[model samples]
Target: MVRAAVVPAIGAPLEVTDIELPEPGPGQVRVRLAAAGVCHSDLSLSDGTMNVPLPAVLGHEGAGTVVAVGDGVAHVAPGDPVVLNWAPSCGSCHLCALGEVWLCVNALSGSGEVYARRADDGTDLYPGLNVAAFAEETVVPASCVLPMPAGIPLTDAAVLGCAVLTGYGAVHHSAKVRPGETMAVFGVGGVGLATLQSARIAGAERIIAVDVSPEKEELARRAGATDFLLASGTTPREIRGLTDKQGVDVAVECAGRAVSIRAAWDSTRRGGRTTVVGIGGKDQQVAFNGLELFHWGRTLSGCVFGNSNPSEDIPVLAEHVRSGRLDLDSLVTERITLEQIPEAFGNMIAGKGGRALVVF
Candidate 1:
């Protein structure tokens, strides 16, 4: 039996218990997790903000060592370190055909498949978001396992699975932030912190970090923000004030709320780009008049999984980490055991700290 944190049902409390993991079948790999990052997405899955099968092991950002592999699994072998890719693109999908693999239509199909069984009652268990990295060990499809980038510490690499990639992609791919350009990151959680670092790496002349928590000001500054502002009704105005009466050239919203998204858009300069990286519920709506849309000439887009191709991007990020251009350690505020995952989620809800890592 392998220990895992399971979400028994949508909107249910997480249960840390043992589950029976099956040997890898064809085209699958078994991994012994070393670490997993407690991401906000896990909170969304546990509370029903996002839809996934019930009674699932609910962690996706992680790194581990390969234990076993089934037939046709050739990319990694036993004893090799690996990172869990929560969203592995299906190469033959329409989006993949067009080179937009991040939006691949079949990425989450595996989330519905049963991969484990509850040890106590024999109830079948599903892998949440495909990788199910919250457990001590997990069995995942071969495509969901990627070799860890060389030179990165195995445990710290957990954030690379989700937060780091998403943040880096939002700045480099989604927003195409240029050096010497003004950039603003709304929210300073794990992903937001990554976004700030990425903006700094991209050489944004003025980096503004916004959040509801004033206590995070120093943390934000540490992660590369030149300025930090408490989020409020006049946040857009404050951001504009910092940009010489003009808003930032690029604004990325990591808060995932309608109000925050609108603020991000409003805080961007005319003809600038605003990328939404936060995942909010459908009920959180933001409205804009047709005239403003026509007149602003601003581009607003949604990003998924950082619009990142993990196979290609991880190496680049790893190089950045090696060169000291990126600080993965700075992204982590607390190191915890698997049992403290629920507490990590509570901190995320309260808008406290940076990433909380579950060290196995």
Candidate 2:
């Protein structure tokens, strides 16, 4: 038996309980999870903000060691450090074949029962996304597990699976913000900070960090933001001033709110790139003038899985962390235990901790 956090219902903290760990089925691997990052998406899943099935295991970003492999699993061995990727690529899919594996629609269309009991009495619990890393041990398809470099710490590598990948991918892959260009990022949380630092690594000349909370500015500045915009009633004007009155070359939306998306859109120069990485509610909508939209020629794009080809990008990110170019350690603000996931969600709701990691 292994410990797992189960959210039996919506709007609740995960109940840590012992779950049976059986041998892997065909094409599956059982991973002994070492560390899991508490992501905003997990919190959103638990709070019913993100549409997810109940009695679900809530974790997608994690790092662990493979202990057992089922049939046809030759890519990984019995003891390889791997990062759990939620967006697993099906190599033969149309998106995958186009070198856009991050947009693998075939792999994501499932009921998310990657791990469950096989008996009639077993409750069918859903695994949020694909890789449910909230459990001490999880069984998943070999495709969902990506091998990481041995030297990187499991805790640090855990976040790279999602937060780091999304932010870095948005900047480097999607927008392709060149060196000496200006970019403004809204929301300075874990992913936001990663975007901030990624812009720095990409040689972005000016990184303007925007947040509703003033306290996050200090950390954002340290991460690489050249200026901070504490969004008051007049954030658009203030941001305009920071960008030489022409708005930034690139503006990224990370807050997952409709207003922030609008802010990010309006804060960019005409014909500039506006990248949206935040996952907002289904009911939310942002309206823009059709005439302005046509005239601006502003390229607005939505990024999932950071436009990353995980097999290739994860290793590159790991190498950056190893070389001390990208600062993964600085993004970790608090470390919690398995039992503290409930409070960790509360802290995230309150907009307190940057990244709350669960060290197993």
Candidate 3:
């Protein structure tokens, strides 16, 4: 039996309880997690914005030590520190062939399978996003385990599994913000905060942070924002005002709200890039006129998993972490126990704080 946070059904409150974790089968690995970050996607899964198998373990951002590996699992061994990659690309996929592993179609095919049972009822449970790191222990396919980059603390590396990767990739990969460019990150959540620092790492001349909460200005600045703005209808205008009538060169939306998505687009200058990483619901539609699209000449693209290939990118992030260029510890606003996951979800909903990590 191992402690885990389980979402029994869509729209249900998370239950912090015990579950019977099976040992690694062929092509599988069992991990003992050091920490897991409660992410907005988990909230999306719990509330039906993202759907998965019933009674699923809900965290994907995590790092742990491998305790066991089944046959053919030669890449990792017992005691190896690893990051849980919730979306592991199948090498044979078209996207993988093109070196765009982040868009791999086979990445999440395992989410439909049951890997655990409820301790109380023996009911089947799936591993949410395939890694199931919300639990103290979980068994997943060997593909989901990536060797942790050297020098990063095991607990802090959890953010690298998702938030940090998404943040870094949005700036460096999706938006491709160049050195000395002006960039703005909309939203001050885990991913948004990481993007601000990533832009700083990329040598952005001016890094703007926008959020609905005024309290987040300090946090944003600490993460490398040059300026901060409270979110409102006039946010884009204010950003343009700061940029001397020219908006930011790149704008990344991490808020997962339609307003912020539109604002991010509106805040970018002509021929700039607007990358959207937020997981907004269908009802929250963003509109753009044909003339505006033709006039601005800006590119708007959706980024999944930060458009990151985790196996290849983690090493770069680790190097940054080692040199103090990246601050993983500062991204975590609260360190918590498994039982506090529900509260973390509430915090995300209330638009409060940065990442809340579950230290096992």
Candidate 4:
């Protein structure tokens, strides 16, 4: 039996309980989790902001050591330190064939499938987002596991699976931000900070970080933002002011709120790009003038996992982490145990810190 934080249903408090993890099936690998990042998406899954079936183990950003591999598994071996890929692409999919693996059609195809079970009743448990890293042990497709370099700390590497990939991908891939260009990032959370750091790595001339929390300013600046502003009604104006009224070349929405989404669109220069990296609630809506779509010639695009191909991008990010170019260490503010998930999530909802990891 392995212990896990299980969400029995929508609106239910997370229950820490002993669970049974089955042996990995063909092409699958079993991971003994070293750390799992407490992400907003996990909170969303728990609170119903993001929809997933109930009685699921909720965590996607994780790093661990491989304990076992099933038939046909050859990429990794036992005791290998690795990060989990929540959205693993099946190489044969049309999107994958087109080299757009981030949009792989097979991603999330196993949503309601079971890999763990209730120890007491033997009821099947769903693996949320297919990775299920909230548990002490998780079984995932071999494609979901990526080997980590020897020097990268597993605890910090846990976030590279999601937060780093998403934010970095937004700037490096989705936005294709060029050197000397201007960039504005909305929100100063993990992904937002990663976006900030990526923009800095990309050599953006001016980087602006916006958030409602004043405490985040220091961290934002540390992540490479040249200027930090309190998000408010006039934030777009403030961003424009910083960009000489031209607005930023690339504006990214990481706050996952309708207001911030609108602000991101409004803060981009004409013919510039706006990338929405935040996963907002389904009902939330943002409005824009119909004519601006044509008149502004701006590109408003949504990013999933930063449009990253984990197999290829994770290694590059790991190297960045190794060279001190990407600051994953600074992003980690707190480390707790699985039992403290509720409190950790409370702090996240309260806008308490950067990235909190559940260290096993």
Which order, best to worst by lDDT? Answer: 1, 3, 4, 2
Model 2 clashing residue pairs (backbone): none
Estimate, for each residue in 1-360, the C-alpha lDDT of model 2 and write its tens digit. 777788879876578877766698789889999889898898888878777667778798899999999999988989899998788877898878898888887765543554664133466677777777888889888888988775798767888889999999999999999999999999888899999989999999999999888889888998999999887667777888987798899999887888889888888898899999988887669999989899888999998868987778878887888888888888889888889988888877777757888888
Q: If ranked by TM-score, best first, what sequence of candidates would result?
A: 1, 3, 4, 2
Per-residue lDDT of model 1, residues 1-360, tens digit only: 989999999877889998999999999999999999999999999989999989899999999999999999989999999999999999999899999999999999999999999999999999999999999999999999999878999999999999999999999999999999999999999999999999999999999999999989998999999999999999999999999988999999997999999999999999999999999998999999999999999999999989999999999999999999999999999999888988999999999999999999
Candidate 3 clash figure, as a count: 0
Worst 10 residues of 2 by lDDT: 111-120
Please tell me which model should have the higher TM-score, number 1 or number 4: 1
What TM-score fits each model? 0.99, 0.95, 0.99, 0.97
TM-score of predicted model 3? 0.99
Q: TM-score of the candidate numbered 2? A: 0.95
Give the CA lDDT, 0 to 100, for residue 38 in model 3: 88
Candidate 4: what lDDT?
Answer: 0.91
Error of 2 at 20 (Å): 1.2
Best by lDDT: 1
Candidate 3 residue-wise lDDT, 1-360, digit = tens: 999999988888889889998888999999999999989999999999988888899999999999999999999999999999999999998889999999999999999998899999999999999999999999999999999878889999999999999999999999888898999899999999999999999999999999989989999999999999999999999999999989999999997889999999999999999999999998889999999999999999999999998988999999999999999999999999988998998999988999999998
Candidate 2 lDDT score at position 273: 96
Against the reference, the lDDT scores of all candidates come to 0.95, 0.85, 0.94, 0.91
Give the Cα error of residue 283 in candidate 1, in Å: 1.4
- Regions of model 1 farther than 4 Å from truth: none
